[model samples]
Target chain A: MERILYGDNQFFAVNHLSDSKSQALAVRFKDNEAIIRTLDHAREAGINTFMCTTHDRIAQICDIIRANPEKYKDFKIYPCMPYAHKYANAMTDLGIAGTIKQYVPGNLFGTMFKGGKAFISKDYVSIMELLIDAEMKMFKGIKTPVIFLQNVMTDLLLGLGMVDLLKGYHDYIITKYNAEPGYITMNMPKLLDTLEAAGISNPIICASINKVNFRMSGGKEIYEETLRTRKFRAIAMQVLAGGAIPPKEAIEYVSGLPNVESILFGASSKANIQNTVSTINNFDSNKV
Target chain B: MAVRVALIGAGKMGISHLSILGANSNVEVVGVCDTSKLVLGALQKYTQFPCYTNHSKMLDQAKPDAVVIAVPTKFHYDFVKDALSRNIHVFAEKPFCLHPEQSAELTALAESKNLVNQVGYHNKFVGTFQEVKRLVKEGHIGEVQHFEGEAYGPVVIKKKADTWRSDPSEGGGCLMDYASHVIDLINDILSPVKEAHGTILKTIYSSQVDDAVYSLLKLESGASGLLSVNWSDETYRKMSTSMTILGSKGKIISDANELKVFFKDQKCPQGYSKGWNVKYVTDLAGQVDFYLRGEEYSSQMDYFINTVTGESPNTINNFKSAWITDKAIATIKKSAKNQY
Candidate 1:
């Protein structure tokens, strides 16, 4: 887990605070060129890891990164899965079978054979592997140290008593990809409990941890409690709390936590990027 | 007592099975399950049998002797496993298990449990195709040297976001949906495929499913087969499948409803002085209890029920046969996609 990990939400127009801002950003970064330019700027700012959602457009970004490996040799990608919109749209076009079919990795029938074998043996973990491999197709031969489950699906599966899938993810990331498994959730406390019960310890968790509750389920107290006491890595996100808290206070409250391993934020401009980085470092200096 | 049956999908083919099963008096339609609420609502109007959204609950409560699974290709693994593990016979619609590996496992389980397993390769039961099989097996077409199978339709020309068939993932497109019929026919009349090689072209719906699938097959019997299928052909008046089998002494040509046999030497079977003998499938269909699409649907179900009751020796479209077809499909798609 890096101390400062750049994010792709801003590049993909995913602002939680305002719909208009999100739409505006979508228009602003509609071109892949703009995305590449911003990503280069982030790289120049000394942030070497881009934790990104596996949106369709991200495939192009991955292509650019792979093409210029010399430029991105030190950079890493933390892929997030089941880009909700892609799945939703795919389900509409292909139905459940077709959508699953599309994600079957290369060697069409070979994947089908595995898909079939996985189905018959009730080896759902193998199917999960297929999906993970499917999502990671574009990032082939690139550096992916960690893979995160998108919060929407992670929390939904959390609610469904499908903790085995989360555990499967953890086991697979370690066994298959040799990468760390990460989870994003609005309800980190509950997820941690579930993961712990699934026998996963000291896992990397990304969540909305801020001074204000913002989108944090069960509020900030339990999040703070987990941060202080839990044996896990924390990547604090939404620290600005839907733009309610100022940057300095947001950074201070998040950094003041006992075990914040990383901060994930996305910005369209170089100034905002520099300012956020400075604020976190300044808060660390003040604490010292 | 009626044979207890449960159905686990409400898609188009599922609904077809529902219709045939509903009309059959030899079986009890115990339950129906589907993922979509609207499809469930539609099934509700057709059966007094209970409906469920989850397969596990339906199986637990219904405790059916047999399961009819018509869900998408991806979901076949779970439902089939659940049924087989519980020692239930299964009648799954084609492309069976989406892969040969899955079929091999499921087939082993069914055989281990002494449970009946059948895939819906309905063309095997069509009157004309049945005739072709008879002639081929009886040596009316002596050791088929060359074979060409074609199926054309207008179902997938435009962007159809309304149906799952337009998408490749859900087992969509011409190869899985249409050409599979041809693959099965090649297996039925000739021999199981020893080799399958070819590619698919996505002309109209490039981003979705392949619109066309073309394959070359070498049957274990040394007969060669060609497949040219296009689901996006708007010129097709209706969905149609046609085939031509060339043999040493004669030839056989057939479409959905008719078969024509050509004997060059006039050394044909008992009732014919055949240069060319034509038979319309309508003249061949025997009396059947319930028939729609083809008598094949009801006929095949009847065969499965008999196998379940130990009345028939075996079904021709068993999971083993489908395993071979899935293998061919996989080999062809691999060759095709790799080309791209």
Candidate 2:
């Protein structure tokens, strides 16, 4: 993981704070070139790692990267699977078979039947794998050092005691993609314990790490204690706590943590990217 | 002289062609494109040839003399058309495309470019089927009156409701994958199917698409036939294709291995008076360099290679025949009576 990883939430119009800003963003980044241009800006700011959800638009972004390999040779992507909104919208628009036809790979019906059955039977582990493969299809030839299970499914599994699935996902990333597995969750502490219980140690877990207890299950104290003592690679996200904390204070609090490995943030402009990068870097320099 | 070929779709058939086409010294497997990184990554351990997951991206780089499409029948048009637009030749799998209009457009494009196009109706070159064609042409069967082509298999048995072979959108189902060969065989011997009336069943095995398709086809040569195929037939050992043809004078029974003819004192090829004459596939007149999947797969590639180099003319399941197959299938769909 890079010290500062660029996120795709801003590009996809996912504002944790305001609906108006998100709507503006949806209009703003509707053109894929706008997303690509912002990604280039992030690259210029020395943020080479793009932590993104596997939305349909990301396919276009992958195409841009693949088409111009010279420009993106050293770049890496952390592709998160089961972009829930995309699938939910697809199900609404195209219906069940149509959604499966669009997502499932290889033998459409053979794989889809399993996926559909898994959904009904709550054998979500197999469905997760299929969804991963389906999601991984877009970034086929691109460099993806880490593939993530998005929070919508990841936390659901966490809440459901589906630890076997966590292990399965972990194993698949290593075996199929030859990449590290990442899990994003709301309750990082519980997820870590489940993963550790399931034989996945020193895992990469992305969650809300901030000054306030904004969406931080188990509270800020527990998060701080886990950061200090846990044997895991912690990628801090939602550090600004949906704009509750000031930028400087958020960066300072998260950067000064004991075991946080990486900071994931999203920005629409060059200034915000530079500011975040500089703030984190300045905090690190001042720590000594 | 090597014919540079880029193969798209690294499914089971793609892998088969990869090994077979690689075995060909006269052809270069320039690039292999599939949507699966696992498949492409797996290919890297063996061959140093270029591999990609996107066809257009691969085409931009490979720029080969020809393209081979071993993808599902649904994707035939786009990949084939992409290659044809570049004035490059293409060889696609059966059921040329999902629709007649697209098939006509691709056929016209390929023809306008004068690019060699072949579809993988490997049964056409199967020795027994070839013999059946030969026997029919020689008037041994004597003006075929009707034929029944049946393709039953365990491929989609037990409601294989979730494979590309079972999805209607993906150009799956028993008819597209299995029955197309028998249809093409009838077309090869008699004439193209001009129209069809049929019933397609999706609920027999609870498939997303039709698991079983039964149809009566009207041939251009004024012959009519029945096609009974069900992918969900679990009684079969595996896949078995058998065609029974009844003619004015005699009849022919053909399967994968044996060609049987029962003559009513018809044209006997210096064999006997009036009885059943059966010849196995080993009695075929030609030999292949190598046999993978079937001799026809290699023969098809070899023929395509030879055609590319001007060694042979484009024959055996060209795109026009594929177009007719496409039209016939569309007609079957349009003609099937609603069960509601």
Q: In candidate 2, how many Å is residue A221 off?
A: 81
| TM-score of every prediction relative to native | 0.54, 0.54
What TM-score would chain A of each candidate receive against the reference chain A?
0.91, 0.91
Give the per-residue lDDT of model 2 (tens digit) for B223-304: 9999888766654434567788999888888886666789887457766447787665545524454333345676777888
- lDDT accuracy of residue A188 in candidate 2: 85
| Minimal lDDT window, size 10, model 1 chain A | A116-125
Give me the runs in candidate 2 sitting further than 4 Å from their true place: A1-288, B198-202, B271-273
lDDT of 1: 0.77
Query: How would you class the docking of model 2?
Result: incorrect
Candidate 2, B-chain TM: 0.94
Per-residue alpha-carbon lDDT of model 2 for A1-288, expressed as tens digits?
789999998887676543345558888988998999899889998899999988888998899899998989999999988787655433322344555556665674465355533232233344557778878999988989998998866764554344666788899899999999999876788788879998888999998888876556656788899988889999999898766678999999998999899999998999998999999999989986
Pairs of colliding residues, candidate 1: A97-B169, A97-B170, A98-B169, A98-B170, A101-B169, A102-B169, A119-B77
Flag clash pairs in model 2: A107-B164, A108-B163, A108-B164, A109-B162, A109-B163, A110-B162, A110-B163
